[model samples]
Target: MKPLLRLVEEIRHGIPSHYHVDLENRLAIAWGERKRKRFDIKPRSRGENLVATRENRARIIYLQAQDEDCLLFLAFILAYSPRSCVDFKTTEFVEFHDYALDNIQQRASPETEKLLKTMAIRRGFNQNLHYLNYMQTMFPKGIREQEPIGETLVSTAAESVGNEMRIDEIGRDDRGRQIERMYSNGPISQVSMFGELLSNAIQSSHQWRKERGLGESTTNCWTTMIPRDPNEDISITIWLGRRDGHRVNTALMVEPTWSSPSLPMPE
Candidate 1:
C-alpha cells in the first residue's frame, strides 16, 4: 500500500485545476491562524474555487473547494469549538455558514482522529478517558471506525454508464421550464472510487460548459442509495437535489431525509 503522504499527494494532484485550495493548504493555514485570537478565515460567501492562503481571509477555500477533507476543517473547529461539530451540517453560529457542511460525515478520517486527540489533550478533554469514549458516538457514524462500509470501491456513475437512462420526470409549470433537482454528499474520501467519479463529473461539467461557450452549468446533481421503505432496514442512496437553486445547505438536509435523524431523546 502507498504511504498516507503519497495518497494525499496523489489525491491532491487529482483535484481539478479550478479549485483554489486543497486540503493540505487549508490545514497549514488553520494551524497558523490559531496563534492569533480572531477567526481569520471568514466563514461566509459564495466562491467557485478556493481563495489564496492568508490569515483573516474572507473565504474558507475548503468550503467551496470539494466535498472531502472537511476533517481538517472540523479538526480545527474541534480545537477551537468542539461542540460546533456536533451540529456538523447545521451550524449558523459562524459567518462561513455551512462551511462545516462541505465535507461532513468523515468520522474515521485520520486527520480528524489525530487532531481531535491532540485537541483533546490540549483542551484537557483527555484528563479523563471516559470523555473520549463519549466523544466517539457523536454524530456521523463512521468517524473513528476503521471500516470502509460507508465507502464504495467502485464508481456508481461509471458502473451505470450506458445502462438504461431514466430521468425523474416532473410536471412542468405554465412556462414549460423543466424543473431540476440537486443532490450530493461531501466529506468524500480522496481514496474512494465513488468520489473520483464525482470529481470527474465536476471536471467534465466544466469542459462541457466551455465547449458550449456557456458559463457554469446550473445542473448540479448528486445521488446516494437509500431504503425504499420505512419498515425495511435495507438502504440505498437515492439521488436527491436541493430544492432551492443554491448549493447544499447544511441548515437543511438531503432530500427525503423527510425528518432529521432523531437525536437521542431527552434523558
Candidate 2:
C-alpha cells in the first residue's frame, strides 16, 4: 500500500481532478476550516510543494510526498472527509453534477467499500480512539503500557516481544498534543490526523520486515514518536526489526516525477 494520500488515486477511474475541490471543501466544512487549513487540505502539484516555515505560516506535510505521489491525494482528501464525519454515502456532491456520479461509482470498488465499511463498523462509535484500540488488539501480543518521556512522547507503548509487534507512540507536538488531550478528555469527533498514515506506515514496514526474514511468522514494527518542529511536517521512520536496526530503504526516492499541465474534464 502506498501512502493513504497516494492509494486514494487507485480508486479514481476517470473523474476530472478539478471537481476534487468540492470534496476538499466538504472536509473543510466537516473538520472545520481551521483544521483543514492547518493540515493544508488543498492539493498541489509535486513541484508545487511548499513548507510554511515563516511566522504563523507553518503547515504539516506527510512523507515529503512528491508530485507524482500526490496524483491520488485528492482521492484521500475527499474519501477521508466523509469517512471521518458522516459516512461514505455522503461523498457524493450534487453540485459537481454528473462528475459526482463518476466519483461515487469509481469509489464503489470492493476494496474501498470494505475499507469504508470496516471504518464504519470499527470507528463509528467512539471515533478514532476506538479504531486505535481495535488495531492494538490485532497485534499478536498485546501492547505494553509505558510512561511518556516528558512532553516529547505523549504516549508510548510497545507490543509483546515477537516478530510481529509494534512500538506505538503519540507525539507531543501541536497537532499531536491536541490529539493526546482530546483522547484523555473524552471521545473525539474525528480520527487523529495521522491515523491513515500510521496504518500505511505500519503495513509498509511489516511487508519490508518480512521480506528480510526478520521474524518467524510475522514482521516487527518499531514505531517511535518524538516531538518535532511545529513548523515542519511529521516524519515517521520505520525500522526493519529490533535485531536489524536498519531503516527500510525503498526505490521511492528514484521514482519518476510527472504531472499534467492541466486536468481535462471527462465527457
Candidate 3:
C-alpha cells in the first residue's frame, strides 16, 4: 500500500524540513531553531582565574502553517469512507463530505455530480496534490522582505531617510556577521527633514505609525516580523517579503492539476 506521503502531496512537500506527516493529525510540526551565544573573554567562576570562552544561547520561536485545501479535500474523501480512519477523523472531513454529498443530491451539475458520486465511494485516498508548492508560485514576487506576524510601532522618518532609512540595531548573523535584520520596522517617510524638524515630523506621524494596519492577520499576508539586533550600526531599509514555501527539498509532484482552481472547495 502507498504511504500517506505518496497518497497526499501536501504530506510529501514538507517531509524533510517543513513538517512531518501524521496519519492522525494529517501533519505534525515543531519549529523553533536553537540559538547560540558566545563571549570573547571568559571570567572567573569562583574568584579564581577561568578560561575565557563563549556562551551558548537557546531561543524558542513560534510557528504557524497553512494547508487548508489539503485537509478539506481529505475530509471530503473520508466523509464517504466505510471504515474508520485515523489520518482523517477531523470534524472538517465529516462536514465537507456531507457538503459534497448534498451538492450531489441537489444535482448541482449532472455530469460533475456523477463523477463525484463515484469518487465519494472510493475506500482509499490516493491523490497526489501538491498544495504548498503551487501556493508559493501564486505569491507575488514584488515583495522581498518578511517578518513574523505581529503589531509594531514606529515614528515617521524623513523622506530621504525613508528612501535610505538609517535603522540602527540591525540584526546580523552572529556566526558570519552578515545578512542584517531588524529589531523593529523602519520609521521613515519620503520627505526629508533633520534635527528638530525631523524629530517633530516623526512625532506627528507617530499616531498613524503606531496604529498602522497592525490588526488581524491571514496566512497569505506577509506578517513575519524579523527581529532586530542590539549594538548594530544603521543600515538601509529592505523590502519586506516571504518565502511561500521552504525549498529544503525539491517538490515531488504526482499530478499537474494538483492544486487546480477548477477543483471544488468543500467547506
Candidate 4:
C-alpha cells in the first residue's frame, strides 16, 4: 500500500502541469479517499480515455479493501497505468518501481516474487515477454547514464571543425542556443582536438535526431569520424547524459519494450 501510494505520488509529481492534478487527482480520489462507491460511466468515444480511469478505480478499491488475493491484480494495473513509469511520458516512475521491488526482493519476499512472476506470465504470452524481461534488467540497479548503450552517427565531416577549438562555444548548439545544463559537458577543447570534433558532432547529432523521428536528442552517445589526417577515419565518443531515466524510457520505446498497448488501449 505504501509503495502504491508512493507510486501515485510520483505520477502526480512527474506529469506535465496541464494534466497534473486535473486528470491525476481524479485517479487518486476515485481510488479511495473516502468510502468507496462503484458506478458505471459511459465513454464519449470508443473508450479511448478510459483505461486509466478504470485502473484508477480498481486501485482505489484494492487499496481500501487491502485484499491479499488481489496484489497481482493491483500490480498489473499499477504497472500499466499511464501514470506508471512504463508509459515514458512521466519520468522516474520505472526507477521508483525498480527500487521498490529491489527492496522487497532483498528482504526475501516470496509473495512479491510470485506476484511478479504471475504478472510476467500474464504479460509475456498474452502480451510482451520483453516487458517483464526489461523490467527485470532494471532491477537491483536501474539504467545508468554512466553507461552509454548505443552510438549514433552525427556527421562525416569530423575533421572540418576539429581544429577550431572554440572553447567558449563548445556547449552551444548549432544555432548558438545553450544546451540544457545537464546535457552540456562544458568546453571540451582542453581535452583534445578530438574533443572539439566530438562536441560539434553531438550538436549536429542532436539536430539530426530532432529532425527525424529516430528519437529525442535527449540522451545518447554521439560518434563521428576523428581523423588522424583530413581523410583518415578515427572516432571519438561524446555522451549526451540522461535526465530522470530519459534514456531508459527512450530505450523502452525503441525495441522490446516499445510495447505501448494498441490504440484501443490507453497509452
Question: Which is the better candidate, 2 or 3, if ranked by lDDT?
Answer: 2
* TM-score of model 3 (CA atoms): 0.18
Model 4 lDDT tens row, 4-75: 555444433233344333333333332322322344595344354465455544444433222111212233
- Name the 10 consecutive residues with the lowest summed lDDT in model 3: 55-64
lDDT of 1 by residue, 28-129 (tens): 333322223335586433231222312224223223222222322333322332222233443232433233234232234443444444443344333221
State the displacement of the C-alpha of residue 255, model 3, in Å, after optimal TM-score superposition. Answer: 26
Query: Highest TM-score, which number?
Result: 4
Deviating ranges (above 4 Å) for candidate 1: 1-72, 80-94, 97-221, 226-267
Per-residue CA lDDT of model 3 for 1-267, tens digit only, reads 123224334322222222211211231111111222334487346422211111000000001112223222332222222122222323332223222222222111233222222221231111111211111212212012222122321221111122121223332332333323222223344223323443343333312222232221112211122334445344432211122121111232233333222234432
TM-score per model over all chains:
0.20, 0.18, 0.18, 0.23
- Which regions in candidate 2 have their CA more than 4 angstroms from the true location? 1-87, 90-150, 163-267
| Overall lDDT per candidate, in order of appearance | 0.29, 0.30, 0.23, 0.30
> In model 3, what lDDT does residue 172 have?
31
lDDT against true structure, model 3? 0.23
